[model samples]
Target: MDKFKKVQDVIASVEADVTKFYEGGNAAAGTRVRKAMQDLKVLAQEIRAEITDKKNSAK
Candidate 1:
């Protein structure tokens, strides 16, 4: 759950950069967006693993 929250926070944190990159054409913001996306991918993988672990344990 904490990792899930971190996922949400990452998404929220990236929103400004996403907007800046798309609407304002900021290259730095686009870089940040890319980094944030990488972070999101890692976090998602972790969450998926955690869920699988929990499910297996419950059964």
Candidate 2:
């Protein structure tokens, strides 16, 4: 749940930048959006690993 909230927070933080990049044609915002995407990837991987570990432990 904590990691899920973190993922949501990351997306929320970048929502404006995503709009600026696509709708307003801002290069800097695009850069920020890219970084946020990378962060999201890492967070997603971490959550995957956590779930795997917990499931395996429960079995």
Candidate 3:
């Protein structure tokens, strides 16, 4: 649940940065968006692994 919350927070921040970049074309904001995307990808992988582990344990 904590990890899910963290992923949600990162997603929200990325959405904000993307909006900022699109609104004013800020290069810094674009960079931040990219970094946030990388973080999101990592978090997604972690969640996937956790789910897989849980399923295997259940079986």
Full-model lDDT for every candidate:
0.97, 0.98, 0.90
Model 3 / residue 15 / CA error / Å: 3.0
Highest-scoring model, lDDT: 2
Instruction: State the number of backbone clashes in model 2.
Output: 0
lDDT of 1 by residue, 1-59 (tens): 89999999999999999999999999999999999999999999999999999999999
lDDT for each residue of candidate 2 in 1-59, tens digit (9 for 90 to 100) = 89999999999999999999999999999999999999999999999999999999999
Q: Which stretches of candidate 2 lie over 4 Å from their true place?
A: none
Compared with the true structure, the alpha-carbon lDDT of candidate 1 equals 0.97
Error of 3 at 37 (Å): 0.5
lDDT tens per residue, model 3, 1-59: 77789999998868877988999898999999999889888988999999999999999
Give candidate 1 regions above 4 Å deviation: none
* Candidate ranking (TM-score, best to worst): 2, 1, 3
